[model samples]
Target: MKILELIRPAYLEVRRIGNNIRRSIEYSLSAKKKDIKIAISTVLGYSEQTIPKLINDLKKYGFSGNSIYVFEGGHNKIEHSFAGYHYYKIDHNSFDLNGLITINELNLNADYWLLLHDTVTIGKKFKKMVYTCQFKNFLGLKLLKKDVSMNIGFYSMPLIRQNSEYLHSFKNTDYTEKGLLNAKERGAIEEDYIFKNSQNIGYVHYDLQYRVKCENDVMYKGRLRRMEYYPQLDMTKYKANFVTDKEWIIKL
Candidate 1:
């Protein structure tokens, strides 16, 4: 069974991270078992000119499969636009049930969906750890209690072996509920409610470094120019040793 990872990215007031996208795809290909077909799903709303460049870079990394998808909608706007040419619009909020519906439509026969975000990059050892964890959970050897959030980190981390059983359980389930988050909080953020509900259900790892960049955000580029190169993946700190780059790995 081949796995097809989804790459749906939601952006609002962030600069285009073309380098991040490049590194992400590279890391995905590197982490695969040489048999899985990795695909990317992205939403419209980044810098208009950067989309084509990002796609061109992906092609260079051999993203020629039939699993690449795009979605429409902005930070809070739902109306479609030409800027959304590369993506499609769906009914729902970000990181909510609509995301699953989009994935199900794209790779209907895929054994798993490895969701990637616009800013997520997989370290050298990420694939090994995720695959092992996912296998155990899928086979009933482990139980993953998590909240399905509307963040890049949650969606892009790569879901493994997301079969029909999992989908059936995930559908119609309003992971985001009113009681979970305050009315003001929910209105302020798009997918806050979903993230709250998905907590502890999956192997949820919070890598703070992968957060979206701000206009004045200051971060070291590390050894890898792309976001895929997670050199700072400290095992002692993050509880996972997903990097082997000596120069970039911080001694925790």
Candidate 2:
């Protein structure tokens, strides 16, 4: 199996990015891939001093294989957030995920792509989750599906060789300003709305422990721990749809 992960570090704090990269290295080591590619994307606005170090650290942190490719861009750059942290922004109009698919000519071949934030960590339990999911799917779970569904959380996901085809099909579709505006008006956050509601995008909720350092210490100020699974909600009501402790299903 071939694996690849996309890392966007510009929106994350330097210290947080460092730790995230460290954890990514540890997670990569635990993966069972015949070939792996770490596709890292950084912004153009980051201090020239910091981006290179971060890239070097990525290379040092166990992603030195020839398959690794670093792609840099500033298109999604956001100068501020609603909370007031001046991190990169996510402009609904300017953000382009197609670039991620195109950067390494990812559209040319089908590979299991794991999209990730630069400030998240993947530990043993998380690694085990991916392995188990792949095992089950390899045994038949995903093969039965005909349409493309997306799994949420950038932590881990399974994309068949045809995922590349799905990406291109999505790219050719039109993006209406009215639709974008309506999406922004909705309760959905920019990234979530785009990834979930978009055409041909199948999503899954990953039940894995992920650690995040919020843009503000205040967001996590009183929390005993800053780690939790994606969707971060009570699951008892939907027990039939989830394992309660897992993160790979895209919510029922």
Candidate 3:
């Protein structure tokens, strides 16, 4: 077992290299810059106050305001916060429910949908990260969870074409049923494990939020493991290594 453990990373690395080559070939033959359209969506319920600033930051960080969608399920709905931003209202005021609702009702035409939350913030070159990712078909994080059992939530991004399949799979039978998030994320975890998307640059709730308290925290290794050699990732501390890099998120 010890020897196998020692050999696993090496084996995974070799396999990753092979997969990268295949992905590169596929990307070269199939992908074009103009063909990729990513729609950024976020749910606002408790954090309505932060929506305006978040919008400003997104535009300031290089995302066109028109490509961003804000779903409001809060006490107040502020429409057209940004010039081209799209605002929609939900029937209920719950992030999990509202988010899922947005998924079910996504009418816009885009190749992919990026689901973000209030806690996670993006900075310069963030859109480039999304555009550069090589996933052909997936609706979860780019790849990997700390454990197979970990649930994927708002941070999970799905391909628009395949949304009807996985996104709608975990819908609660009864509207009044509880633990909608648990149901949804558990479904995502199961689906992602079955799919096992190849190396693509993306982040989720954990990659940036699961931080280290002690110097020896495994997230240090986890962050190091998830990364690819990209200058943009290295240029910004906001990319990953939340724990290893001592950039822990303070939840509001």
Most lDDT-accurate candidate:
3
Q: How many backbone collisions does model 2 have?
A: 20
Give the per-residue lDDT of model 3 (tens digit) for 29-93: 53334333323333333356446766777777676766677765532433344456776754444
Sort order, TM-score high to low: 3, 2, 1
Model 3, position 46, has a per-residue lDDT of 37
Report per-prediction Cα RMSD to one decimal: 16.3, 15.8, 10.3
Top of the candidates by TM-score = 3
Enumerate clash totals for all models, in the order shown: 19, 20, 2
Compose the digit string of candidate 1's lDDT tens values, residues 61-128.
44543534444322333333344223545443332233444555454334444443333334344443
Off by over 4 Å in 2: 1-30, 47-50, 74-99, 103-110, 117-207, 210-252
Q: Give each model a TM-score.
A: 0.37, 0.37, 0.48
Q: Candidate 1 deviates by what RMSD?
A: 16.3
- Scanning candidate 1 in windows of ten residues, the lowest lDDT window is 232-241
Per-residue error at 68 for model 2, in Å?
Answer: 2.2
The lDDT of each candidate is 0.34, 0.32, 0.43
